[model samples]
Target: MASRKPQTPARKSWWRTGSAWKRIALWTLIAGVGVGLIAMVALLTAVYSTRSSLPSYDELKSSPNGQMVRVHAADSTVLVSLGPSYGEWIKYDQIPQVMKDAIIAVEDRRFESHWGVDPLGLARAVRTGIANRGTGRRLQGASTITQQVARTIFLSNKYDFGRKMREAVLALAMERKFSKDQILELYLNKVYFGGGAYGIDAASRKFFGHPASSLSLAEAAVIAGLVKAPSHYSPTADAEAAVSRASVVLGVMAETGKISQATAAATDPRTVKLAPEPRQNSVRYFTDWALPQLETLIDETEAPLEVWTTLDLGMQRAADEAIRKNAPGDAQGALVSLDRDGAVRAMVGGKDYVASIYNRATQAVRQPGSAFKLFVYLSALEAGHKVDDIVVDEPVTINGWSPRNNSGRNSGQITIRTAFTYSINTIAAKLGQEVGFGTVADMARRFGITTPINTQPAMVLGTSNVRLIDMTRAFASVGQKGVAVTPYGITRVTANGNVIYQHEVDTSHVLVAPYVAAQMTDLLQTAVATGTGRAAQIGRPVAGKTGTTSSNKDGWFIGFSSGLTTGVWMGRDDAKVVPGLQGGTAPARAFAAFMTKAVAKRPVEQFETQVTLPEWQLEPEDNAYYTAPDNGMFVDADGNPLSEERQPRSDDSEEGAQGDEQLDQDWIDRMTGNRPPAPQPDPGRAPPPRDAARQPPQDRAPPRENPEGF
Candidate 1:
């Protein structure tokens, strides 16, 4: 073969020829083009399949995401936003150029050059992600601004190859449908900037307390940096991280020629002023308590809602500060304040909401102790008992259980006013028996105490658990002049610009007769004025009661003044005793601290004057010496008997002994008909020399027997 025709120059094998190599390259290119065409066809087909499910462009323009539910205080202060909060949509012309430049530098420097997706960036991201796999490095994201717009408006946040293909397709389609500026405006308005804020406008106002048009270069950089990881770079959540990220943004801005290097270096990220955050997160407690009420007030809708609540932001701040300052280190405290009309003004569910979210003011059910005596005294007044009526505070047994005074020493004889003022448990127990436990429970229910009230003997001493809100509502009823109150938070709710709901006060329901309320007010006023609740006084008329459960596991002070009713409770969540804790101590002091500031702007209001009643007189034969069947003796020269035959005194003798001087004389006059004038000494005759027999009786020794209970 080698000898034949000199091998034809070995045929110059086509494989090694230059022209053959060029032909081979051409074929390789053609095959690669064919493969790319098939891939593009598959991608188009997949994108077309998802197109039908994508939201229409107009739909995306309407609302890219669900609207927020904004809760506002009574003064129009924005307290919280439940979802994505959006501000007024800003036009492209109104957007700050610096903001746009900063965002472009940090988010997408190639935004102007790319149609939608940056091919070079996509390739780099793929290579880096591949290299980073299994290297403990997070995979890089290659979403362009157009891609983010597509995702925010049309796609769910699911990570997969299918989503990526759909995103690319949508971005391409968006580029064809909208101009670059339109896409950027949409991006700036629809992107979430953390802190519940969405859009550049909301982010600007939220972080700088100004509109987007007012953003400075430094502030713009800070806001722009938030786009990558809103929560992680939130100026409020982490100021240092936010500033650091902002510095990176500034550097990139200079490098991209969007800003001068000198300008970038001159900008101080630390100097950017951020809006002041709430003093404490405890406002979340009020928001939590009010959110459920929102659900009940209106039908569910995706439309943005504005809930104007009755909360007083100033009072809320005061209440929060009071709780934090007064709540013992080892214990927690809660407070609920309401207007006389039953609108919630402020609520502190716990000293620290971050530590626990259980709303003790509305959720906890603990013994009210003497605080429950409010219903007992009100029931007595409704049953025709005078506040000045004498009732022996001696230990008394009811159904084999004896209830004693909180002092653990029985006061020999005191008016109902004195007994209530001192929080005498024995007197409360006696009144409970006299009025019938069923009547006491009914009275509690009538005054907005929704919690179940037991009719057992111990229940007379507040052994039953009750919520602070219910108790505050009950006291508000008294402050409302007997009108039954239902505590409400949201005063009005509006959606888009239409009023969806508005709270209406119903004063037609009466919890007690006006005169009965006046009588109860009189008793409560005395309690705070000079008795156990004295610590709750704020130099104005206050009517409240103090309660301390056995072992001091719970302490409470519930009071009302100047149309504001507040209840304070302190205790451990587990109901363990707090050493030295009592209603008269920290709880009452907290009440004073809160009410002092809460009522500072309000005019002083006096409780309704008590109605006059016939002087309570004891019948020597029927009431002077009554003995219980269980050997419990009660002796009172001026006590009224619990008998059907006993009748109001027909004669105005004014023969009953005078009450303590510490008692209000005007109140005593209202209870008793009128006191007779003292005998005048003869003008010329020396007053009879003071004699031991004529001297006032010495203070009676405290009863020897120590009571077994409060």
Candidate 2:
């Protein structure tokens, strides 16, 4: 009935009567518009949020990436790099034009015309992304140079809509503030070039062994092609892939009018030669020792830094070779050398840095063995003992501790110089008791021995562990005529030619008395010339001591010339005894090898010493008295005397002096020419003047008319 009533205009409610295709088209258009509005709203929200959260443009420009910290050798050559990036920051104009063109042609042809965001590139990227989505392929990226700079400076490397919006906004802002060249410069410097390099300069130097300013056209193309994926196209990693990428870059350069077709055709990627890989090797240990010092020298800065260190590449290499040649097989060792001013000239921390980075020269804590007797001897000298003072070398016991000589033979009665030359453990122990162990420990500390010391009788035997650096520094104090020195590596730190920090050496603090140092130097020189350290002679006047620990666990040779103070230690890292290793053996040989190369460029100079005590005479009454104990304790001058047996023996004080050469392999080697012969006396040389050793004791005047008392 209702249909009958509406029959006239049932006329078709526009829906049923209207064209079906038209109706469907209208709805489709409406739905598309609605979806577009939603997407537009979302994009607008993202842009606004990202813009609000972006860092200020000034902040971004100040430290776009991490600062580059370089470690330079003594000659101002780069030794190593320490930072998130390698190489240095360069200005836009410093960039080679060929490199710039290659980059522009391959990375972004419209780089000069875009406002940070290339519209055509974005469109092409969108089309490609949609087409690849169905094929499930990796989506391609279309980032302009400015966009890359923006991301490098401000945004993280996350793939998200929000981050991309922020990148675009920041890139637009960067375009507004910085010129295109400036943006390009920042991009080149901030981009990662693989192989742990960041920046065009680093990449250039890393791959070509030269600087970016020296890049050729073909080289520029090779580097330019690496920006897309540094490791993937690294010439060092894969030459074929790198050459293929470079060829593509050259073709693009031709197409973009950056290079002529003939030039592109003529260039061959195969002709490109990479540099030899650098061998940081042991030099890295020196740099590692130098890095922590920067914080104390300069305030932290966002700009790149150049730290000029005191490392001599030649000396370092020689030291490394010496260790390799002479060090006991499978045993670890270290070598440290310092100039007279305490500049660390060479430091080899270990046998191989690649195997272990632990810096034995600066960080290892081990017993100094008899090397520490130098300090004990110094204490005794300060306590009124002369180099000619006689001490009995016999078995002695102190607090249940009896010390024995390394060779199981005693000189009976030996002068302090002879005792030290032989490194007699018993005489050193008795001296420790005589001067007080606390005094010896304090003396060591004054000479820069920071390792903890136990003031026990065994302390004289070098039972206390010490660092090679400290030992070298202690010897350096003696070499510098008693002036204390803090061993330093970095001489100056600069940024853009402006000095951030310049080290000012302090040469005023005297750690030991000048007379004591001089006397010690004289005695040590005699030791090297005629004692256990004879193996260390390098055709020059060398003052040194040889130290061998119990059971040959550690061996040390610490010495000084007028030019350098060096210390060499050979031992097992695990503290296990190394068979057949002794201070007078491998360690002394290494010392000679190192000093030979170290002093090659230096003019020869002798030690300067002046005797301070002229009128002082060693009187018999001034000596203490000692007696042998029934416990078989021969409390002689070389042995620790009990409080009750501290009686002096005057009869055995004057003994026959032995020859300069001792009955040891070290001495035999020197005499038989098994090693390099000592410097020969020049023809018709002047008669040697009377030295302290030749001076007669003023108290021994013809037994003095004791004839009357008899």
Candidate 3:
């Protein structure tokens, strides 16, 4: 064929006549066009593939929203609501006109004119995005109301080009299938507001504590403004931000002719009063205490649950008020009150549950101070030592560790009962050393103090950390006449009126002998009546101990009334020492105040008393350096009378004068078989005014336990 054409003067075809570069350029253009068409088809296919199956117009006639789970208190009173959906659903007709207008003004100005997909809005958004690229500013959104409704009903909250394309297609379909009012109704019912609220009605109730139809102009503006970003514009989370957003909404409504300029000016978001956060859950601490037990008793399920607990609302309020009234101003405090049977009646973990959720009563582990001495004393009684047994309160060292009395004044060779009453650390430490620290730790564990304990000698003075709940449990055991019980909060749990869990009456075991418990009660009563815990006296037979750490870092008062055992602790979270803080002061007063109110309806009963061995018969000549005569006077090893010389002395002495009077003894020579002689007293010092030499300045009370050379 080419040869025949050449014979006719070589008539060239279109491609053969052109230059090589021109032909190559033409082919490249044709190929580019073909590839572009293929890409267009592929893009269309991808967009169609990504489109989600949407609900028909008939399906959107009714709202299909989630329901919330409500939490009830012990008294069957609705305390709070907990679930993904909060508050109630609302109908489109019930929505306030001001709220809807504000939403349209700010979110979609051309909503009425668009067919679910607005080209003008899209162009404007694209231009804005281009202008803000790499500027760290949020990109402008171009989604119409119908598009938003489509996405909410049929798509996830993903933002991308493909998702946008799919949303556009769905929005177009929605416009053709449904009316504008129908789309708006679906959007209003499906949109998410913050605080677990899902719709306009829920958001109105959750934040403003009212129905959507009852919204004021300012409130309506605030609710509409939250649609942009629920968390960012939450009224409770950021009031200023919410108010600012509301102002912007009001301005938009004014500009869009939805409201007059005067109306917008008069509507102040600051004047819009939201509900006071549902009264702050008056018994929130009780709920927190019962939640763990509630979880443990029930199986995992999404169904709503109701729990009946042992919390006494009156007692809870009293305890909260007392702690807030008496706790150190700069420190936090916790209190746990239980019935005699170990049922939790009241709990106050901190001053404000909303501010902090840490359960200090059950979760915090702190040194119990002298409150731990109760264990040491109980161990001594268990080890065959009577309450009246004698223990020297003189300064002594063991394993290079020496502890002192809190008063810095040692009453030499005092009775055990007396030592316990005064909270003497030296005697407690000596008793702990004598009874074996291991024995004390075991005793604590047996009494329901499940917290870890150390066998160190210092543990006798309450150096081991323990929880307030455990201490309250141990004290309740004593009040229960030796029966140890596990503290519990939930009494019954019912789901849909069917009892799922009912606390089998807590079985109790004897942790202490009846006689020992009675004696301990007596000892603690004495401590409250005439000793360090005097502030805890409630005009009745009460028993307790006062605990103060070395640097005032912790102060505790654990005591029992006739029908309840309560523990209170006051301290700083960072363990900083509180000035002038003492267990016998704020903590004891708090205990008494709480008890007075908690027991207002109950009658007072006497604590069971126990009689121990007589003080005189408790001694059996167990030492060689000291002897207890019939008159409770001490005699030296050389048969010399030292009663007048061995008097209560200042705790600062190191082999110095025994008391205000200075006296020395002269013993006879053993080689010559001569008798020992008593020495004369110094006449220069006349008794040192009794407490003058022993007492510290009023402002400088002796350091707690007079820390042993630390």
Candidate 4:
């Protein structure tokens, strides 16, 4: 053999006399050495590449953890977090052998020895895939716990080989970056274990209702099973699947020498019993209703911000419970509550948020029904009409318009207070006709009514639509002593622990006077104390109105206490009316539910609406005199009520103030919102109360026939 090889060294050139076999052997040896050197360089390069972004051992081992956003209750318990998970970080010496070994055995048996990738794993996966060609029983995962942990921390939700490759690459890098114990700690914190729980700490509390340090073997198996398919193998969702998975993990723990075979076989089937879940979805309904309004804060800001609000989560839950419990069997309801300062404390969009996201409190615009009468009556009280002022209720027509009471009967000669208490339509129409329509319209605006309303007399009947939030805000103004406050959800906005913006209270000054507001409050109190709102009465002197729209399409009950104001609206999601359902039935019931639950142990308070009442001035005469028309009072040349007679002797209207109070209580209650019809006098004369109207008798003709024409 030595004689054969030495000949090659003797002849250095290709053309020199050397055996062909010797030249071939020399070339093969050189090529093999070059390939080996190149492979070594490549392996070193790949290992270095992954380690570039990884932190050092000291950094991983010594640092304390922190999070991005954490929510705290007033008492300071962490309510929630959107941040890195924590709670379980044990040193290898302290970690349970079974848990640690199960993780390694079920995930990667060669974990203790491999730098990162295992050549045997790749070959086995390829073989398994080929064996299960079409039936789809392929067994493919060969990732070590390190690789899996790497993917969870840095990878996207997308599933593909590229991510897997990146996981393996990062794993190798991480091996160089951190020790084994550090890698395990990172893995524990990096993965998503489902149920909205992030770290082992949250998971412990979420699944076992305890801390991770105290988890039992049974509980440990449940957590171990979640590593493969969290949602599917959840003890809560599929106990059977979780049991099977846990069994497998247990077997691996024993086989891998992490635990004794006796220990593995000793696990009680009952050990993996799921923890009872509480109502995890808290205030979701209120937040859903508030989302659109919350978006407003975002629009007004420039940076990523966190919103802090005045929301009383307890009150929110109460409101939601009330609406849900009292909603009609087939109907849904919404409730909105606001503070006197216009801060929204709670808002329930519907009976259930998961069932539907149509936030009726903020989104649904429905007819306010008799609730609109609050504005109408408030206007009447402001225009110098007493709550006890007399108003007529008759079968008279104006411009062929006739209004009736809900009971479908004309109220005969009722006081303005009585008509309002009763919600009589005919009387309200007459009041609307007497007070100028514009007066009522202006009062409506002052009261914070934002919806577009018709100026016609029928508008007093609540023909326009209003949202529950607007109703809550408008009522909040009443509670705020006639100062309209816009209901705002977010009170303070912060970013990265720095307050970037804060909400300034907005007061829209309304009310003709403090006294004017007080008068309206008094009427509403009487409404709650004895009228349609009797159902809403609490131990306190709450004031509010009840509204049942035409055709019963919308039902509303809006009320307010000293510090809180609420509006309840009930109707079909569609505009179609639900028969037999009205404000008194559903909305009032909803309000009652909330009040009964909310007012417990709270002291009652009286309303401040007395300021609105004028000094108790009595009418001068019980039998006030009216001048005969055509006497220069409020008559035409023919001494007849001018309007109807002048319209080609039309039958399109009623002659004279045919309805009653000297006025119609219905009209005043309605506030037809006009300025008391300009205090018309008989066309030819004034009344006896004015000294025979200056003696311009019925026989006399006025200088100007229609000087104060409508």
Candidate 5:
């Protein structure tokens, strides 16, 4: 009886009632609507924030996606084609119909009909993403051709919600302003195809060795496939992968009715032929060095430009070959050659540019060693000291440092010219002290050494670091008759057939007096003629200095010849010492090799005659008083004379007397036009009393530690 009463009144569950279910459905609908409103507000906020930073439509329309820049050598040889390699702009109608079809078929099927943002394409992309989740398949992108144009022109390929919103907004704006054909043209021209190529024309040329206008269906399909993944589908990178992708592109084209299935089947992807990869030449180093100068010379414009450089291709090739042939196997070499007007004619940054792009000629800064002595002697001459002025080459202390010669022995008293020719460290140190280290540093700066110079006693021995280009420019000043020279590479820049920039030659700023330059030139000539830099002699009137750092970590030969100034440097990038590596060896020989070819066509020119100075005399009691030998003979530390047969022929000579006899004969021959017999001394006046000044100084302090002996 109780069960029957309960059954009669048993009510339906609340959730099962119609009113309860209706309430639940109503709340669910409200929640979904609120979320949609929130998303709409967030999207609007993102669009509003992105609109302000967008570039103007006019700017986008006027500017080409890729602009070409060409650099030409002095001989009009193309040195490099910078930016986009295609200098000619391709118009929309000029693009092949097959190319357009291939791109549209694979990239956006509804490109002709859909707006910038395709709703059907977006829904399909979302469905694809949902299906591809955790399936290890790439999700499809729904960006229409117009949207791609908008993104490529005004936005980066950053995958984020905000960027998408901005891209959508820009796409709508672009759709309103530009025709579909115009958008398609921009996308075709602006898209990158890897291998330093941009645009369809460049890609076609780079991959097929032909223009886009001549592309075949197979080629078009291949290029269209590259738009998805340039590096992966590049014919140059992977021929098989590129062909496979092209086959897929052809299938898509056939399915989309852009091409007949029979035509797609007849076209063989394997028939695609790729052009040979371009060889990377060492001349790229020079172009790389000169490229940055463009920004400084001209305004930032998207127009194609032609840069006429001062580079002499012949000389550049010679320099590259010289560096390759002369640089040590374990070391790298760099050479920079400049005309008297400071035009950079040839520059080799390293033995192989492909191995390393760090430009040693223009970028590397290393100790110049005795090559830096050019500045020191120039300073001495500027300070009222003549080339023939007496300077003690004996051991001396400066600021607790004693400087010694490369031979670890002193030549005692010697003329400034003779000391400089021999690169006597003690004499250089003494002169630095007398004239002031600050003065020496200032002289280097005046001569175009832009790097910071440390005003220290050791700096007199070339302990300061310097760039090869700067050092070459300094010596160029001397070759320019004391006029300051600023090294320049670009001669002129033109755009749209209009000259935009031209280099002006300025020789009004004088770094040193003409007489001082002449005197310094004489010293440098002596150095290359019979001293440490003798290895650099190219059977021409070349003048330069040899530099060998303390540990032989760096070797340098900077000189001028036949209206050309060149600097050669050899060393390891890590500054590791190279055994038997000296400035007079590899670097000097490289200079000779380079100059022999660099100046082959130039007329032989003579340097300005040296300025003669009054004969210097010293008091008999002065410890620095001494005389040079009549026969050009030099004595060793033990007072033993070196015989002609025993004298070193290379720069390893202890007293830098390798070619002294030859130099003496040359001077005599030049003066009289004939070699004369050596004048016999009057028994040398009792042998000049054994040169008492050569004796070890008993009144001086003990020798201090000498670093970086010259």
Candidate 6:
């Protein structure tokens, strides 16, 4: 009882233990930890499930030979390959161990490793790279065999970390679905070696003139080295680099124990014994030009499809060779070949496709200069003017639009044939005026131009940009007796031996009557026989025109023979002047080179032969004026110069015209910063961007003169 009394008295003390508070905190912490554990478990479950459930390899269906492209000559030969298809796909067992080992050793050392990835190899590469730079700033790759295969099958060729993660997932999945041997074989077969070859077998034969089974160790190494950067390490682009890269591959293989050190060290990269003559085969320009025409035929997003085109590989090669032989150092060229039916037989966009992706034959819309005169003359023919009609090639102005002749001075009176043959701009402009700009644009559109065409008279003079394909097609219409056909690349496309798509000559509309086209043809014949396009002489008749745009931004030579139609273009990508050149210079020379070689083994033919000359000249007027904006002015603003009477003045007064345009001026002044300050072309000549149309004709400079001796 005394002890209980003492305990009660102790409770009355002010100092007290905080055990209850401590117990409460302990229970709360335990409950919070249990809830946190549950949340963590849920989050981790979601993460792992999502990660582990990534698309597996079993879901991926290998594209069954995505439409094989058999690039051919007029005759049959495997000129090139451009599809996931195959003529023959050999397994690793079929390949010589040397070649197989070289490829595996160079591409992926641990080919037989965990899943599809080579984690240890990757780690080693990253570690070594970091050690060298003492930082992770180096651009290095850590893709394993599976990753490489996955990327080729599922991704574009751009390097990034997202792509890396996707690659890992896909690689793991791929390993789960395909056997190691199958993955290795597919990867080897899918790799691209330059020269348009797509696999080891194709490359081996193309480069070494032998199969994969027969390649030597050095040759194998060379092919292996190309895996990293095919075009860059190509034997054609840089033989020394190819050899050097090969040495690196061989050394790597030895270091990784895939090949003996002695074998790698003794490998004679220099004595690799390449083919006697380097493979000069390339239809890059031609194929590039052809690719665009295919899009017009089908939906581009559909599975890769074969484009069985009419392109003759031989002609393509010859054209490339000619361009190389005759092209200027800074200049590039394009060539096109079509049949009478409008099937584009061969096309070359530029000398090298890998050097530039610009498809000069299709993507480049150049001013056809004199070549554009073809349409002008065609319009003249359609307007009931015969090839024998005569027109004056004299300097004249009409309706505020005046164009100069390419020859600098007019050649007095000339026959229509003579005017075209000589590329007399003044006469061509006269014909354009007669036909009307609307007529000319209509005619051009009918022939296949998908470009804006000004209704101004100058539109008749090739001011509208046109692609080489459309240009050639228009000229071919004349060759085809006026039927405008859509240019087609693929003649037949088959899948599983079943035709999926086929292209026949599709004549859109009658561009010009046969008689009119024929008449135009008769006139252009004179062009090849004597006009500015005479350089295309293939020891045969070729009727076409020479086009050189203002300031020499573009040069063109388009012509057609009885069997083939071809056009050539030369210019810079930005449409800037290439000083000291013309349509008949680089372009024509290349045309002649390609034509000479192309027609070498073919038969000779002419343009449905005919003779036409100026039968009679038109009568001269009191004040000879040209009409039509593109054709230069044929009459004054009142249309009276060539008519019965001329207007006296009121409306033509500058002040009256300015007053009438006062509203326009006000709006323009407001839209611009303020009121127009006394017009100035020089503020240091920064006279604000101008509306050339609003200015008086005299304010504009005369058209540029054609270069001498084109």
Which structure among the candidates has the greatest TM-score?
Answer: 5
In TM-score terms, candidate 4 sits at 0.49
Better model by lDDT: candidate 3 vs candidate 5: 5
Model 2 has an lDDT value of: 0.74
lDDT of 1 at 457: 67
Residues 462-561 of candidate 3 have per-residue lDDT tens digits of: 7677999999999888888788867887777667778888787655578889888888887887667545665676766678887776456677899988
Q: How many backbone clashes does candidate 3 have?
A: 0
TM-score of each: 0.56, 0.56, 0.55, 0.49, 0.61, 0.52
Clash pairs, candidate 1, are none
Off by over 4 Å in 1: 1-65, 85-280, 406-409, 610-699, 702-710
What C-alpha lDDT do the candidate models reach, one value each? 0.75, 0.74, 0.71, 0.61, 0.75, 0.63
Superposed by TM-score, candidate 4 places the C-alpha of residue 442 at a distance from the truth, in angstroms, of 3.8
Over the stretch 1-710, how does candidate 4's per-residue lDDT look in tens digits?
Answer: 55654454454676366788888888899999999999878867876876886766556544433324434332333444444445655555655555556567777788778777776886787787888889756356677778876666556544577777677788888888777777776666555676656655567677777776666676676777687787777766567877888888878777877777898899864565456765434355444444335344543322344556667667777898888887776777888888778777677887765455457887788767667777777677767888766565567555555444322244345456556554666666667777766677676676666777667666666666677887777777766677777876656656766876577886656555667667777777655644556457655667788776544456688888756888998778875645545565567778877866665555655565321211111221211111111011112222223343222211111111221224322322222122233343454663436333222334422111011001
lDDT of 1 by residue, 1-710 (tens): 36655444546756566586788898999999999999989866755565555555556667648557888999998998788778888889999999999988888889999977899889888899998888876545588899999888767665788888778898877776678998899899998898778899999999899999888999999999998898789988788999999999999999999999999999999998888865548778888888767655787456788989989989999999988898878889999999988889999999877556678999999888778878888999999998877777676888766654323466566577766665566777888899899999998888877777778866666767799999999999988888888898889999989999989998899878998988888888766654556568687778888877655667888999899999999999998867656676688889999999999999877566632211111111212111100001111112211122221221221111111223333433433224433354464765455433222223543221111112
TM-score of 2: 0.56
Worst 10-residue lDDT window, candidate 6: 622-631
Native-to-model Cα distance after best TM-score fit, residue 94 in candidate 6, in Å: 29
User: For model 4, where is the 10-residue window of minimal lDDT?
Assistant: 624-633
> Candidate 4: lDDT of 257?
79
For model 6, residues 1-710, the per-residue Cα lDDT tens digits are: 45553454445432246567777887899999999999778755544554476454334334442334655444555456665423257766887777777877877777886767677877987787777785546546577767877776676555677777677777766666578877877777766777567778878776677777778888989999998888788775678899999999899889878789999999977786655434333465555556555555554333545456677767767777776676566777777778778776777777666565456887787666566667677777877887756566567664666665432455554456655665555666677777786787887777777877666656555666688988888888788888775676667655445676776566667877888887887776655543455456666656777676554556787877755778888877766556545665567767777777666776655445443322111111200111101111113222222221321222221222222222222332332223343332332543354343322233322222232111
Error in Å for residue 531 of model 4: 0.8
